[model samples]
Target: MTHQRKQIGSGRNAIGDFAPKLAELTDDVLFEDVWNRPELSPRDRSLITVAALVAGGDSDQLRFHLKHAKDNGVTESELIEAITHLAFYAGWPKAMTGVATAKQVFTA
Candidate 1:
């Protein structure tokens, strides 16, 4: 719990009251409840989240999730393939944006 708080609230040097509660929900519900589900692996979830973020043009959040995706075993090739596949159905622009995000992720 302390470790989670330290990581999440460290940037601003304060918990901001809501930080604790946010951490609780993130730790207890977000991670433990949904992320830990056996039906989907962490890697798969990260991949999906990154893709959604890319589609939504949420680059700031996408960058974080891209790193998470890489950490969880989402390879560059796999990301490229996913974006390429998404290009057809989800629209080229969105897919292109995903490719740009992937490029940043890979370069970093």
Candidate 2:
């Protein structure tokens, strides 16, 4: 089986067909194929992904990614700096929400 198919088979069962495909794309393709590239460290990738998710106001996704960001060596201060930088461009509200979520993740 292909890497995506293997991941799909091992993943949790979902109610819809598309959800599994989406998960495979995100897990195997995005995470494995792209994030695992040698050029960019996992820490940098996590920082970029988390910042994009936060700026996009994707709270649910951000919450999950925040933890991964920490695991990938994204420090609390770096996360805060990212949010602060986004505030000027992506809006303060989104940054505020991201900051709050980061706080929870840092404390956990």
Error of 1 at 42 (Å): 1.0
Evaluate all candidate structures by whole-model CA lDDT and list the values in order.
0.70, 0.75
Q: Tell me the tens digit of each residue's lDDT in model 2 across 60-102.
A: 7888778777777778798889998999989999999999888
* lDDT by residue (tens digit), candidate 1, 45-97: 88788777767767777767777777778887887888788788777888888
User: Cα deviation of 28 in candidate 2 (Å)?
Assistant: 1.7
- Count of backbone clashes, every candidate in sequence: 0, 0
**What global local distance difference test value does model 1 have?**
0.70
